[model samples]
Target: MKSVEEADYVIVGGGSAGGVLAGRLSQDPACRVALIEAGGSDRTRLCTVPGMVSIIHTTPKVKKRFDWGFYTAPQPHGAGRRIPYVRGRVVGGSSAINGMVYVRGHRQNYDDWEAEGCTGWGAADATRCYKQLEDWEGGEDAYRGAGGPIAVTRSRDLVPATQALVEAIAETCGVPVVDDYNGADQEGVGACQMNARGGRRYSSSEAFVQPALARPNFHLISGAAAARVVIEGGRAVGVELIDGDRRRIVRAAREVILCAGVIGSAHLLMLSGVGPAAHLRDHGIAAIADLPVGQNLHDHLFVPMTFLAPTARHRGTALHFLGGMVKEAMHKGDTWFSRTVFDALGFVRSSQAERGVPDIQLHCLPWSYPSPNQDRPVRPVVDKRPALTVMPTLIYPKSRGEVTLTSADPTAAPHIDPHFLEEEADRRLLIEGMKLVREIMASPRLGDIVQGELHPGPAFTSDAELAAELPNRIHTVYHPVGTCRMGVDDRAVVDPQLRVRGVDGLRVADASIMPRVIGGNTNAPSMMIGERCAELIAAAH
Candidate 1:
């Protein structure tokens, strides 16, 4: 045991949500806050590039330092293949290394949370928080907020295929094109709104953390891994951090906030003896409280349905490079290549006929997209040919999984069992989604542009074929949630205000607390959670 320094608040994990919370809480000036991050700073050039995210994914130098590099336990549903789970280890967390798509999801997704024991977290309640964090470049309205820290802009590098897909889907499905998916209605095809400005990535850390670093009340400690929450008599006191061979304990006078993400946050709670008693006993850790810490893991599973386009107009790999150049030249009033290459995109409900909410989501990229398991090409080969890639994601999965401690060590990654494709319905819906993608691509509007299906080829046209091929092709959308779920029920890990039911002065403020995963990209919602958490904590004071 070491002498601990006390602060009004101690926040674990200075990633997406934590960054916002730290910034907001320390704004009170009167309160001293300490934000501990397990990774280093986000000063790398790789993190700033909006179009080069895929390049970073394949590079070992960046991956080794910035990524947690976690892998799931062998999934029984996916035929025993271990799913790779990448979480951001840097100051911005996953937002520092994500695709940068800024989606708020369907409003009903949050309303459903209120229905499921999260009383004040309904769409109406949560949207305000979402609005507060965004500085929408498209301008402000009732749905979007202005003068906020996080810059949300439309992508500058939209490819032709993406625009074609949006137009095709709208014409074929009769789903009207929406200008903003984060607006009045979420179930439509339109351009994807992203967290980009001036052709650069705007992560939460960049938007929130960087600015807050100068505040005297705010203390940000990077490279400090929170080993466990220090609890005494069922209340969290602070946390223990491991630095080299030295252990340091820090105390929080007010509360110990856990924003360690779905996997990290839940693992810390369990390590602090806040999970299932039987499991805790087996790990040789005393159980302070028995709760379902990692019982309800959920994620959106996706299968890519690629298409080969006719003519050399598709641009393929050149689109990213050209898009960058067009953006740069456009800054200098050169619009020569602007109209020829578009970054247009859209989203639609997977099953529009059966829908109360959207089940499938689509993202179009103008390139010869490869699957996650595919090896990177050794050299950049421009196929002076047309190509397009459409990714169909299963948004609201019926299948559920769990995360378990492989070892009691806090540094060790947990066994994540997402159990993808376990439910027959999930598989059936995915097949339908794939067919929908094919239909959208084959629409009269896009038919003239596309040559044929490149993946799930013409040979495997039937639903049975899709079912057989999907298992081998499917990968995660990287939107895992519900592990440290929030609800009033016994199985719930935290309550409506995000406080651990059996414990005091501790709460989870991340995607893990989501009772159900949102309908679209989760980065925006995660930041909203952080913003909302700050409000909730401020109210508590």
Candidate 2:
């Protein structure tokens, strides 16, 4: 074993949260900052090009370079089979591989955080943190930011099918199209905003970390996979790592922060013997603290309701030498299904009767697929025949699962169990959401473009038929959160300050600390946590 570099802040995971945290903390030239990423650089061919997103997402190279490609334990309520779960392992993390959809979730989400004992995290104060990071294309407003690091653009150059879909959703829901979902009204169909610049995907590494690299005090190390945090008399002092066959340690003088994401952070803590006492003993590890390190896992669940439309062919991009790539920014890549895959989005209430808050999120894709099988990861159906897939997701899920250690080996993947639709309420809402999407599909504006239903067609009409089909039909919306949950409770792994409970000089920042799953996509809020963590740590100095 060899002791390597030392820094004022030793940050684990050069991911979404870690990138932002390092960028903010290193602004003070006096402090030395280091960010370690297990994966390599973010400048890959597929990652850099926006239109090649599908190839990157579904290819074998994904597991090797971009994603961790974790698989879930067999879900009982699901098809009784393991589901493929993808988490980013690169510089920008999932922000590198995601759909580039920029959703801040609802104001009620952060307010709920404050109400749950996370002080100074209400929507108003959180908005201030957002303004400091966002460079919104929609211009400045009370809700939108104008001059910030991340460039957020509301999608333009929509296909005619997407326009029809949005119009149809509005007609069915009786809500007008609101240009900005991140703005005041979040309950209508509109072009989804993205973290992009001139039609290119702009990940957090590009947005934050790249700028801070100019400072001599800040440093980034790729392929430095963290093995464990060194705890000296209950204070986290450094991070031990596996660099090839050689062993190394990067000591921290001020704080050792864990931004290893929901699964990665919690898995590292357990390996360091800071998880459930009995569970740690099973892996032949001594317990540092008998805390619930991995619990309260939740995510958005959706079922792709497929439809065949002859009118969709008109909006489909034709393969041409110069006209391919679809986006106005790129001209030489493959023709994408649409300029933005998730060009149109909708928010609706399904779980509860309340009109103000939405429990369902609708992702409208202009291309279609055949009847999906349960053996593999879900991908968009690719064919010349124009089709559409409307995936209605249960934003607020009741089902809970966990991430547990398979062994003490840091290289071994953790056992992930999202337990999809385990609860009866989650199952009920899944049916309700699917039904609502069907109604929107049957509406006149969109129905005018329809050919027929390819999945759950006219034959499977009853509620019972749809309910029975859920085990094979439903899939993840790819938003996993709440593993190392934060609260003032006993089961909480981190406190409201994000400090790891029962330890000093250690804090967890990322999606893992979410007390409850927010009502929308989680990337934006995860970045917000990074901003807040930086402020809190700077205050202590």
Candidate 3:
């Protein structure tokens, strides 16, 4: 290979954590950092405009350009189907393509991490990091932060249907309509907060990576896919990169941080012979460290309950919304398009949930469809009639799956088996969640506008019927984590410091290091992890 390009720190994957680390470390001036991203630029409208999100995941041409579009191996318990897994391959990573919803998750999520032996990662520490990262439009409060990079704004310009859904949730779920669910209490209904500013998405690349690029000490290498971590004498030295027909190596003088999300991080570990020994040997890779690299994989799964709403109107609503979004895109300003598609969000406890903690999350969309397909090419097609879809999602799932290599080739996609709904408890909890959402939709406030149940209709009411039908209806919430889980146990791939066990000069940041997936969205927490990782490295240096 050609002479190596060297840096004080080499971070693989310019996603949430990588972007933040690169930005924070480069600020020191003395620390040279190199961020490697597999995807190209995220400068297109498809990555910036909130309304263009659906189009990015649906259109074949657009999807290929931005998304990794990994399909899971057939899920035996989930109707024996192969699920479409959408992860952003752009410079901003999934943060660019994800629904700009910004949720810090419950503080208990981090507390639990500390309880599980991840010291210095409690609720208090996490909150401090969050305050340091966010520039809230709501201004600084006891709980919220200000004057930071990420712009967090509450949903604005809500449509009538969304307002009704929010009201219905409070009335039927016996919860208050709190302005900020990310604040004092999470168990309530209200508008969602998004990672946006002035109608434009503020992805991690925009918030962190962009500024870091201006620094002379920081270098960004795009379109360079990491093949494996170079290990010598049980220490990670550098990374071998595959850039089309060319190959190169980038040396990490201090450390090698993997922020390549859950799947990508685990895949790279196995490719570098850092995973389960037998599994690596199966692919002809000599094991470097035998650990549970791809175990404890889990995620949130939601089932959509579509309802017909007379108030949503029978004609031109979807078209009118699209037209307005196009106009808003042209003007490059705030409009209804700037808001999340599902403006209303709620957190509630299921019947089987632990006291004072919510197990269910509800996302209410103002628009709906007769049939929602997960196939990448044909999805996101909305019906002309005014309809709403309330997705009742299980926030903390007990089900676990794994990520393993289908081949030794780094370019080939890894085998992702989410093993969704395999656990009886997850299946039971989701059914309870669905029942709770149905009650909210059936409330008097929304009952007037509602026509009828369109999907998993009224006829299927009993628990047995719902259980039988779950396999066909359930899908991922796009938050996969725990593949390279950090803890104090034998199964732990990384320790509390996020350093990969048995390997020196290597760490796995991002969602993969999460001992358990947080109760809410992963994007915000991923960024927080990035910030925390930077602090750790800085202090050590």
Candidate 4:
């Protein structure tokens, strides 16, 4: 193996959290930090196009670069089909390739983490870190922060269908209209805030990595894949990297921070003998620690229902090109319409009688939006005809999955078991959510505009029909988390500070460290984790 020089910190995976950590940690100028990413740079035009992200989802060249095109083991609950799991292999990770919805999740979601044995990770504590990394275009408030690297702005355009969907829900269901979903109450209908600026996607790599490159102390190595962490007498020493055919070892002076996301991070831990002993032994790896590394996997599952409209008023159009120009020229600081149509967003409980905030979310698009997994080119579905799509998502899933080592080889992907709809309660809740969305669409405000149900049709009305059809219709919202869970329990992989349990000179800084998946998009929360991890690492040093 080729020996490499040591650094103050060796951060594995330069994704959202890792990018932030690299930027924040190297701020002192005296500290030498090396960020290793398995994928190449985010220099592609496809990466910056806000609307074309789905186009690159299956493109082999693009997928090879940033996406570790992983798949879950055949899920029995999913009708014995293997679900495709797309994770970022590039510098920005999933943030570079995600929908760019800038959601911080419910405040109570964080508080629940603290209550569930994850100390120092409550709403108040996590929000401080959230504020530290955000430059909210919505302006500074008690909940929002300014002057941060990541830019958070409202959508430049609202589709007409989205607006009508919101109006319909509010008028019928009596849900309030919230300007900011990240504000006091998440249970309402409104527009969605996005991580966009100047009509371009602003990923964490663009926000954090690009700015930190000017610092000489920060060394970012792309195309370097970490195979394992080298341990010396129970202390993590460094990492073994496989760059093409070459094998190299880069030592770490302080710690080996794993920000490789949920699957990547947990798989790396198990590969390094940090997982369950039996599993490690079965994989022919000697056990270093027996922490439950990959046990609590969670994700938001979304089922989309399409509806046809009677008129063309709610249809989306490419006319946004003219609107984009106008926004750039006349209303620079104000709103810029990306599409002619509007979108409505809301949150509601699967059961309103249940305590706490809503555990389900609604995103109504005023166009025939294609699924993220679709291979066909996305052409405007209702360029001249009005259409709408109601997407109901299961936010707080009770079903937990696991990530297990399939082999001792680091190059091989781990066996992921998200176990979607494993529990009957999850299925029941989704059915209820679907029913609620149908009711919203049937409301007097939106009902008059609708022609008929476009998907799952009006015939599939029963709960059993919805449940049976769910597996085929539902797709992931791309918020996978809780594999390397942080808690104060024995099964916890990391402690309150995100330091790996029973391990020194090691830590985890990503969504994986979340004890439970937050109720909304994971990007903002992951960025929060990065900011918090930076503070903890800085304090420790």
Highest TM-score scorer: 3
Model 4 lDDT tens row, 497-531: 89888778999999999887887889989988888
- Tens digits of per-residue lDDT, candidate 2, 451-506, equal 77777677778988888888887777778898888888898899878899998999
User: Worst 10-residue stretch by lDDT in candidate 4?
Assistant: 373-382
Using lDDT as the measure, the top candidate is 3
lDDT of 3 by residue, 155-199 (tens): 876668778989988888888998888887789989889889887
Clash totals for all candidate models: 4, 1, 0, 11
Q: TM-score per candidate, in order?
A: 0.93, 0.94, 0.96, 0.92
As for candidate 2, its clashing pairs are 368-387
Candidate 3 lDDT score at position 43: 84
Q: Residues 64-105, candidate 1, lDDT per residue (tens digit)?
A: 788888888776766566777889999999999888878898
The lDDT of model 2 is 0.81
- Displacement of residue 476 (Cα, Å) in model 2 is 1.0
- The CA lDDT of each predicted structure is 0.80, 0.81, 0.86, 0.79
Ranking by lDDT: 3, 2, 1, 4
> What TM value does model 2 have?
0.94
